[model samples]
Target chain A: MSKLDQFESVFKAASKERFHYSPQELHSILVVTDLPEHEAKLYTDRIRDYLPLDGENITWATLTGEEFDDIGGLFEGIEKYRPDLICTYRNLKSQGWQWPYSLGEYLDVLTQATTTPVLVYPHPEKKEALEKLGQLKNVMAVTDHLAGDDRLVNFAISVTPKDGTLYLSHIEDKRTFDRYIEVIGKIPALDTDVAKTTITQQLLKEPRDYIQSCRDVLAQHESSPKIEEVVQMGTHLDEYKRLIEEHQINLLVLNTKDADQLAMHGLAYPLAVELKDIPMLML
Target chain B: MSWFTWFASSPTSVPASLAASQPHAHHAVSLGVTLFFLVLLILMILSLALEEKLHAKKSVIVGVFAVVSLLLADIFGLLPLSQAGRFFVENPLHEKIEMPVYIPAIDWGVVAIILGSSVFVDVTSRSGLFSWIAIKLTKASNGDPKKLLTYYGVMTVLFSAVLNNVTAMIIVGSLTVVSLEKLERREKLLGFLLIEGLLTNIGGLLTLISSVPNIIVGNAAKISFAKFFIVACPYVAVATALTIWMGAKLFKIEGLTNEKEMAAANEKVQSFDENDGIESNGFFWFATTMTGLFVGTLATASFLPYIKDLGMGYVALGFALIMLIRYKSEADKFYQAVDWDLLAFFAGLFVVIHVMEHAQVLALIGKGLSVIVKLGPTLGSGLVLISASAFSSVTDNIPLAAMLAKILGNMNTPSSSGLWWSVIFGANLGGNLTPIGSASTLVAVTIIHKHGLKLSFGEFVVKALPFALLQIALATVYVLLFLR
Candidate 1:
């Protein structure tokens, strides 16, 4: 079964909220993609792990570096998928692509026959970290694509007119498989804030162990920003607006997921549309 | 006889002197009331004078004077003690008199606008330049007298509406004579334009701001800027049409000159079309903005009582300050054109009327008129119009218009619409009757004198008075018929 077959209800729920944001028809198939393939395959079963199972048509595709060498073929491949969405990881080399210029060729190909809604969900780690910080916990900043581990750059930033010191706690929440199952129960009632804080508090229940994970991640840091642990919730768009305004966040990072599965399901897919004004990058 | 008087109460021929000696309190009450009213009146005057810079100065002076005066009078017991005060309080004597009632403050808007517009027109209507042009245009026609008179009448009517009619008449009067110098028929053109001023107050009627009393009515009624124009534009059009129609009959000239003379004059007028002294009315935008601001402030004043929203008296200061800043060079020139004497005249007249109001003389007059009308507004409106017309011929329209405006106030009645309309009609049209009737009439008479064209009071009455009377009658009829 395709990844799109796993989660069709997430897209339908979003579509119900606003017809303008929804696909043109109720039966529109969402085509999903996970790109810049890594050595370890992302759990393809994760698509089916959540979201409702009915009233959707979706397909999933995974792409690698050489496949993108021919731009025309890549664009043709996008249309051939007949996607309601095209979720893919960003290339680490350049800044995120701007609309029209960024998605124009693929969109142009879609317009030739099929015009689909493309959604991308970066890993939700940064959003979860920002939400955790708002809940009166340790603060963290996403390093720029160019910023190496010299942490003095953002130290001068202050919320008020006067300057103040900014310290990073490198707080990490490491969840075991058994705990994540229990977390799904709390997830039903908790909002983005509740969901995020609960996860942080759970990891910090044994504060020494959580700090050790943070130390290891920081110690092994490359020039590229490490992905923060992602927390999923029922509503992503509202959570996104509040986080951006409150935190003055300017960029969102995502992981490539099957776009067809996303257009048919989770906030991970719609994250691209919600954060359109800001830069979104896929890890 | 004394013993018998004590027993028999002096046989009742009259009450005993002791019986009458029990004092009546009416005098004491009247005395105290009159004095109390005097103090309040004084305080109000002081308040107004200090309102431009309203502060503790007026309050301190008024407070001290009030406390001291009351204390001093109390010490003397002239403040009406006991039965004396009670006597007058129980049975008051009412004094009444006949006075015209009208809508208030709107007259000042008229005066401000007329004066402002007049200053503008005066600066625009070039006497020397218009004269030069007129002469040149008339020369080719060998200076035909009738064509010159025709041009003079047209310009006079046009300017009269814009400026005070008399000033327009004068400016046009001078140029007409200049234009007719070659034809040697300057008197006839001068006379025609002079007469035209007597008839048409078209400009005055066109807008609430154009005339003194219309503004007074507009403000008193709290009419909106947009609504005033809507209501008044038709009346003005009808009035102008009626005046023109009647004026044509009155000014019907006999025995027209041939085309040869007309052609020569047309060529002469064409010849003097130079641009000297005819600036492009450069302040049109400023004038328009100020006019809108003025109208807006007045319309919104009822909703907002802050000094800024009240009227031009407060708002004009700001406009003046801006003018001083932007056009500092022309400040003096503009000041010269202001007619501050007219402003002073208005102020002095305000004080005089205030004095009368303090005396309750005007109130007495109002009460007497209320008796005949039974205070019913429709009849009151007619009586007021007749009286305003009569008085306006004696004094300048400003004071009379103001006095009538205050008396009428904001009377609430079904007929008040007519009454309001009547006040404007009476005050504006009444200004047309005699040389003393309006600032404009005097202005025209003065300029006619300058042109070597003599128009005596008696002569003007014989020639122009009938047409002027007809115009006022038409206005009165308009008020009674349509306004109601």
Candidate 2:
């Protein structure tokens, strides 16, 4: 409780962690699927058309289901190619996609085990994945705790086409918020009302402030996508689903890695599992 | 050298059961009948122990056994069927009169206390008091793993002393997960959780009403709430500190080496914003004050005029009623949240034990236990503690505590005797021996697994054995040096 320590705490509380934006260049893209090469070629062509990398000399590689036996073999293929971004659909090397309960073990491990950002295309069997081709104009970045997620924002911005709209959506889970608030209500010292308002504002404030910073920085770019922020407190899945439909978002960008857990982040897994018709960029 | 000599020489307080005037007179039954009832009791315990594997609810299993035992007892003419509405027909003076046969056996005082405490704690928790204190403790540690371990360990014990073990574990275990994750020290989560789980049992010993076993044994022994706290606090403090120290060493948790790292960690945790959990200022203060009053009232219930007569159970139920007034419209929610399965299990177990008593099953066990007590005070107490601890590690401790309390009561052992303390300590501390041993430890393992960490049953037992053994050893020495 020294003066310096007190000052450090005050400073840390006041200063929010801002998003650091850097343009991510896609030098090579790997398209992976469980279809045959001929069928995979058809899907890869559709992916190439859908992606915003129109004029770049990007090395494109396709690995059909037969190319790898398991998650290990898939990782080996990925290590050999060393793609800047891996373009794939959910339920790779598994029949889980049909059930919509998971993203299959391959994608689950792929998202967390590697540092490479994954551009998750909708399953090839889905008509929406085919129809959504050549439509990467409306990109949206979603997060449960949206503050300090610079990499996620950067990836979303990089993939968005010029003159397209980039929606930065932050949904503070109301259930979780209320749960903590309920615990606070039992505490004698805390002014529950002040806590309710101040904490809610603070929780939402960090992300809102970071999103504003994004707007300010992106405003300077000559051909940057127009930014729109959708920040509120609500159930994540329900809110995100509503926002996606309301905005007709073409691609959803989110972070998949949880620093403390081995599994994919709690919010990310359900979103990845349920939103099968939407292409999502998992970082 | 005989148990009778030891019992006669010992200075003991009059237990409530003994004061109530031996409700049912002990009668000799045929050996075959005694063995059958004993096997029935053993079967109930075994079924309860394998509850998870059997995929049968505890309440259902015990309820089935209770019905079977009652039917057999009725057939054998052990129960006075004509006096079904009376607990004790000997109460011609109307001291303990007019209760249904099953009602008297259930020990409604214990049930009331559990229900009341459960409702009160559940409602109080809705105010976010526990989480606020937890986050504050986290911030206080400045994100140092070693400091965090110590603070969380002590908090686990204190919380368990007031809250039930499962609730205590959930609150502290969750915060541990969040705090460790924030500090980027998730690698230490398993150790923190394991230590917290172990400390809960130690904390349970701190108060008469901290856990079910404590309530059962404490009530049976007629130990005052104040006395229970006084007797158990020293052991709890020492054992909690040792467990935390042992965990720190085993897990290799250490503090920041440099001031820079300390400052950074402090800054990181300071951003936690403890007040973020609070939702209602009015309710928070109300809950805080009520929690204080609840503990204060329970501790001094013996001194209070009306409450003294009614006992701690009435005080608990009364406080729960007061808390429920706030959510009077949604009272059903709190009621629904009550652990009905546990209450049902208690009811059924009481019936089974009551029937066993009718068949002289307790008298049979009492004969065997008398031999152990004849081994001299220190060695006898140590053996009982060891045996209870071992039995509790594998099966539900509630029935063990209840049965032992009855057996000891039947033998006319003193309330202040080391035997009573041994059973209390053994029943509470034995849970630390394995994940399945206690609800709190099981919860800790579940939390670890939920975070995608692998901590199998063998792994938990291996890691927790040292702490459990040391705790039981400390309890044995504590009983010998003080309680005896």
Restricted to chain B, the TM-score per model reads 0.63, 0.93
Instruction: Specify the CAPRI tier of model 1.
Output: incorrect
For this target, which candidate reaches the highest TM-score against the unseen true structure? 2
Q: What C-alpha lDDT, on a 0 to 100 scale, does residue B448 get in candidate 1? A: 70
Candidate 2 DockQ vs. native: 0.03
lDDT of 1 by residue, A87-126 (tens): 4322212333433123323432332333343333333223
TM-scores of all predicted structures: 0.43, 0.66
lDDT of 2 by residue, B169-200 (tens): 88888777777776778999999999999998
Q: Fraction of native Cα contacts kept in each candidate?
A: 0.00, 0.00
In the range A141-257, model 2's lDDT, one tens digit per residue, is 988777888888899999988879999988898998899999999999888998999888777778887898798778877788988989899998898889888988889999888
Query: lDDT of each structure?
Result: 0.44, 0.84
| Interface RMSD per candidate | 40.8, 11.8
Residue B153 error, candidate 1, Å = 5.4
Specify the highest-DockQ model's number. 2
